[model samples]
Target: MRKQLLGLAAVAALLTACGDTCDENKMVSGGFDNFPAPSASADGPTPGSAADFQKNVQDTVHFGFDRHDLTAEAKTALENQAEWLKKWGGVNLLIEGHCDERGTVEYNLALGEKRAHAAKHFLMSQGIDTSRLETVSYGKERPIDAGHTEEAHAKNRRDVSVVR
Candidate 1:
């Protein structure tokens, strides 16, 4: 009986020594220091958009590279677009900003914002109601033409106007 009691005590001691060291309270408390960042937008030009928008006027506009500032050509393009909008007042215009796949994400985001602002300003200047305008930036996510050519890059770095 004495030996059995001693053996039971030793077993209890071993069990206590080898017991789970992981604190349940530690798990109850949050432990991570950093979280993963979000993925970029996957949405691009609608499939068969040109064929669809052609039947009904989209008045969509495009822009040039690294340039958020509206050029003479851009202004002329907006003028034609504004005339069309004035005739068809119900359609809302969405200014989607795009950038070449070269710059950093943050830089491209700011550039995209500037491009959208430039187009929005043009529309506002042309007396298209600002209420009907929306701005979105795809950064370098969506390339109209995916080839790594200069022409492709040039075309990619643009603010396209979509009538949605």
Candidate 2:
């Protein structure tokens, strides 16, 4: 019984030593001192960044049901987007077309593609370079509003401009 008690005490001592050594090594090698403090910017997002574009200009346009045509409101949004793109010549854009969840997947994909092209063409006409704009269709897969309502559907049928 005494021999068993001594064995347990030795094991406890070894475990205590190992715990302290591990902690010390962790403090010396993986400490927060190795990381630099983050610098904060007061002027807001950097120019030509995605945040800047979204902040300074409208980046989305809603479409009517089953329509790929650009409404006057959509045209206005695209105009603003084109101006921002022109100002930030180095920034490229990805135009994502999303659809409401009423149609078949194949049909929605085609419609979404048309919607994307509609936005892209409008931007191109407003003097944004075609080379800087790419288009993609999300069909009914990525709705902004998941609820089954007209208002939600309207919000889901949209073209969003993303900085690339």
Candidate 3:
């Protein structure tokens, strides 16, 4: 019993020592959408870091309900992303397609794929290399906003560009 208590105490101490560092690392490595954006300072994220990319260029674009087409706003955001990619020639991206919760799982998955492909094609049209872009569809499986309202559903319908 004494040995077990000592082990528990050590574990507690280690966890205490971990503190906020673990959370920070997780947020930097793509935590929930609510995680605050990294602050820009003199010693901000490195120029080619994911945080830098997110800060310098928009990383997400929203789609209309049940539609995979890019909106004018989405096209503008993708244009900015293309410019950023052009500047960082060596960086690659993972385009994640997501959808609202209204559709059947299979249907949502297919729609999400189309959404991701739309973004990829736009980037390619802007002169970004095809080899540097990959895409995946999460459908409604991973929603940034979990509420059932229209605003929430709108938020869920998106394509996110993650630097890889």
What are the TM-scores, per candidate, against the unseen true structure? 0.62, 0.76, 0.75
Residue-level lDDT tens digits of model 3 in 1-164:
99999999999998999887777545454556544346444567678778899888999999999899999999999999999999899999999999999989999999999999999999999999999999999999999999999999999999999999
- Those runs of model 1 whose alpha carbons end farther than 4 Å from true positions after fitting are 1-64
The true-versus-predicted C-alpha distance at residue 78 of model 1, in Å, is 0.9
**Candidate 1: minimum summed lDDT over ten consecutive residues — where?**
33-42
Candidate 2: where are CA atoms >4 Å away? 1-40
Candidate number of the best TM-score: 2
Q: Between candidates 1 and 3, name the one with more favorable lDDT.
A: 3
Identify the superior model by TM-score, candidate 1 or candidate 2.
2
Which ten residues in a row are the worst by lDDT in model 3? 33-42
**What is candidate 2's lDDT per residue for 41-82, written digit by digit as tens?**
366777778888888898999999999999999999999998
Tell me the tens digit of each residue's lDDT in model 1 across 1-74.
Answer: 99999999999997797579746555544554333223212343333343333434434455566778877777
C-alpha lDDT of residue 71 in model 3: 97
Stretches of candidate 3 exceeding 4 Å from the true structure: 1-43
Model 3 sits at a Cα RMSD from the real structure of 10.8
Instruction: Give the higher-lDDT candidate: 1 or 2.
Output: 2
Model 2 pairs whose backbones collide: none
Highest lDDT among the candidates is held by which one?
3
C-alpha-based local distance difference test score of model 2: 0.91
